[model samples]
Target: MTDCDFLVVGHGLAGATLAYVLRQRGYRVLVFDPGQADSASNVAAGLINPVAGKRFALTWNANELLPAAASFYRELEQCFGQQFFFEAPIFKIFGSLDEQSALLTRSPDHPWGDYVASLATTDPGLPGVQAPLGGAWLRHGGHVLVRELLAALAAQGEREGWLWRETFDWTKLVTDPTGARYAGRVQARHVICCEGAAATQNPYFNWLPLTPNQGEVLDVECAGLSSAQVLNRGAYVVPVGGGRFRVGATYRWPPFADGPTETARQELSGRLAAITEQPFAVVGQRAGVRPAVRDRKPLLGPHPTVPSLSFGGGYGSKGVLLAPRLAGLLADWLEGKAELWPEVDLRRYAALYRPAAGS
Candidate 1:
């Protein structure tokens, strides 16, 4: 049985990024992934929008996380010998004068205001496709080629003897006083679960408040679309490299078992058409569950009772923006070098459920 210092489950952005971070720290790591479950990271357009939506509120913790993510991805590029991050400005088009007024109104108090450039009074190059009442540019925001990055990391991990492509069977797991064992076989110093929404299935953390939401995105061919800038009107049109754009993200609370449905497709298409006059062909449709929490904060840190098990998830739609920082934070915490964020530390929640110390 192969033994390592660490074993991570799942290879989505969460797991993959964490594995990369741990490996960089000189930890002997083995990453296992089934590669079957629907992962939000795979289908994500990987947008990093500091300023977003009609309200245009800065994404939670954008100030602290954005720069950290940028630096992390750059270093990863150098390590992996590949580029997956692009610094692109988002074009937020105003559907009405009220929208423009809203942006101007909030620009001052909003922490992301300095990133927002002056509005363009005239419609730009994609006029045939979209009309602009005026739009602002968000600086220091861009997109990450999520799948490419994951694949690159996976490849690098493989070359470094750190990745295993297989489903993790919980039934085969065994634990003793010394350490935890997977399948009563491979032993590790610790096991960290990065299973995304699947973390809800783990018996230990299953009790954690998880409000998984289903989101869908349509990959369309936008041959003539100009610039890689993500277009924001009703739904976002994010460039996916190679002249393709991912337009979507329909949020369904209950979730559907059948995955993508005709109703959702029509709804997304209709929204895209409303935002742009251009005729685009739908080349692909993808759906996955966002591993969100009610408070919308990440869940990280070691297990409460299990000394050798750790967890890091709850990134939801912002996995691309949140994973790198959280990965570094997790690594630091594991190494006894840093403290976990109180907001994300699972111990904060455990205290409410589990009995108080010495009580």
Candidate 2:
């Protein structure tokens, strides 16, 4: 039988990070990654902004999550010998007078004090971007090349005899009090499902709420536009150097079309126009679905019934920030070195698995 300490399903950021940490800690790991078509992490912009959205509220756990994620990626860059982690500032352009006024009230003494690096009322002067109202420089905000990093991690796992390329069939997953045996060939002490949005298909953990967020992005080349920082308004324009940029992301539910749609393209084009006054051409466009959790936090821990099974997914757009620290925590918990964080623990959803209160 193909044996290992853990059997991790799915290789998206969540699973990948967990596998990486487990491997580092001297645990044997075997990963089953089908490399599905709509893998959201592959198309993600990987933006790690501590504060986001129109309200400019700080992410739930930004203070501790951001620095931990950054440290992981920085070390990953050195380990992989690639320049995938880019630590740069994100310029959040103020949309109107209301937004500027709100930010003005959010001085250094506010709850968001430490996250705000600097606030400016002067024009940013990004060539293609229009900046009449100016913006704020969010310190330590940056993007990671998620697709490339996953590839590098997979290659390393392969060399270490832990990477497998195949889709897991749930019917073949045989479990008992001790562990699980899959496909009649693989055995492990525990099986963790990090399927991202695709966990909805898992017969065991599909009960957890995992709403799909369809997003579309564009890859365009603009010769004259110059900028190093990520621009966020309603949409974001990330400079990929060589006069090319990655832009456009529309969120929708029950995603009608599996691929890019003309409607989203027009919407993004409108956002581009609103962000920039200069002329630019859209070169390419792609779309993927994010697993936006119902509670706006990751779904972590084991199945209520199956001792050998657990889950780690539902990161949504904040995977870049949430994955690293959570991965370590999951590894520690799985190895019996620590307890699962209460907030993300699957036990919170215990009511769902129970029958009606009086019944």
Candidate 3:
């Protein structure tokens, strides 16, 4: 009945990446995804920024995650015969003297301080942009074409008979002492639920404290901007294709009504307008709920109750940079080789769950 060694739910970056890694390891993998509307990974700008504003701190695990991510995506490109990942510096514009001072103030103690260099006293070629106090330059940080990568992975999965295109039937799902089962049917040695925000619905893990963030982005045509470096001000204006750019994104927590709304669009548009003086046209507007957690860390590893079933999500805005590395760790843990990240391991939240009444 269509047996598979691994069955991964959700075809977003997390799911696709997990499946690809297992397949590379020579395991029989099957993916279940319905191509649902507006999964967070689909709407992500795929920016891998090292230094973030609002404290100018290095992203969590930026040093290790960045190199691992670069090597992983480059290898995937070679295997899939495609070019979607590009290495470009990110230019975070300083809006005022205070923000610039804040940046220089924290440079010494910051982990990513090495990548943080003051604007060279010479012309850097960036034009038509406001640089009040100039800004920091990050070397290893760059962008990945998320949509293209997803499309490639899906295509590759289809060709290899590793992908099953359909909504995951929870009723058909079963777990026991041996391992996880799909459709009350096909037995797999491992089953990972990379279902993004949908993890909040899983009875076994619902109480783990998932904070879904509703975010939106505006796709605009910003013609004549040649430099592909990600432009960041109040909001990030990331170039996508055909002189078009994806600008975003506003965050709303708990009580966050899912899906795109007019309110979000106006807020995002206003933020973009405030940052750039160049004429821009809004071509599209989209939104999705990111599966963020309270500690701002991703949730990975096995289910607290169901040992066989695992989860990999809650990456929030850093899904592009975080998922690949975490997916590899999941693979390692499943294969019994490596220890899971304590910050992401599900056991960290075990105190919240009551262990299903009794053992």
Candidate 4:
């Protein structure tokens, strides 16, 4: 049997970043993932926005999380000799005059001042965007090439002999007071489930209020649009080099539908039309389910009863920005260097875990 310090199940953003953090700290880490193409990390736009929703409220803990994520991605870029993170400004178009007035009403001394790079009251001249009410130029926001980053991390892990391209079979996993053994081939000092939306299916973590949310996006070729910044209204249009842009993100809550749908395509296309007058061709469509939680906070820390087994998911749409920093904290907690932040600690929901009958 191969011995390791951590056996991480799933190689999505949460798993990949956590494993990288743990391995960097000199732990023997093994990662298992079947490489689902539709996994949230693979399909996510990897947007790092500090402000959210129609109210334009600052994202939860943006001041701390944003900078940490930027630094973390930069460190990875230095290590891999590849650029995966792109720092770009987000042009948030105002939906109406009321919306524009509301944003302007916030004083310059408002907490959001730090993130506001600029504000416009008239059409900000972009090639074909239809922002007559103008928009806000949000700084310290951008996108990460999530799929490429995960692949790079997986390659490095493989070269170091710690990543496996296979599904983690629950039937073959044996957990006890000491640790966890998998398929009789690998024994780990601790096991962490970073499975994204699939965590709802994990017997160990199923009790957690993990709600799977389906989201879809479209890849389009818009020759008229510039790739300098991301354009957002109800949906977003993210430039991905050349004349190609990724548009979308239609959210579908449970009683979940499967795969890309014609309805979603029309919805996104309509939003795209509202954002720009530029004619674009739909090149591709992709969909994935986000691992959301009841409280909308990430799930971290060990299982209430099974102390050696832990979880690190429920990042939902903010995985790209939240994962890196939270991974470090999880590592610190695992190493007994610190405590898990209360908001994210799984103990917040410990009352939900009821042991199986006669287990």
TM-score, every prediction: 0.92, 0.95, 0.93, 0.98
Consecutive 10-residue window with the lowest summed lDDT within model 1: 350-359
RMSD of 2: 2.5
What are the lDDT scores of the predictions, listed in order? 0.81, 0.85, 0.80, 0.91
The candidate scoring highest on TM-score is: 4
- Per-residue CA lDDT of candidate 1, range 184-289, in tens? 5699988888988888788667767778888888988867775557787778888877878888788888746567767778988988887677678999898898
Sort the candidates on TM-score, descending order: 4, 2, 3, 1
For model 2, the local distance difference test gives: 0.85
* Local accuracy of candidate 4 as per-residue lDDT tens digits, 1-359: 99999999999999999999998899999999998999999999889999878889899989889999999999999998999999999999999999999888884657695898888999988888899989999999999999899889888877877888888887688989999888889999999999988988888889999988999999999898868999899998888888998997989998767789999999999999998888999999999999999999999999888868999999999999999999999999999999999999988998998997788
1-359 in candidate 2: lDDT tens per residue? 98888999989999999998998888889999976655898888788888898888888878889899999998899998898878878889988988898888876457675777788787867777787888888887888888899989888877877888888898799999899999889989999999888888888877888887888898877777666788888998888778787885789889358689899889988888888777788998888889888888888898888899999988998898999999999988898899988888877887776432452
Looking at model 2, the pairs that clash are none
Q: Model 2, clash count? A: 0
Q: Show where candidate 2 strays beyond 4 Å.
A: 354-359
Error of 3 at 45 (Å): 0.7
lDDT of 1: 0.81
Backbone clash count for every predicted candidate, in the order shown: 1, 0, 1, 0
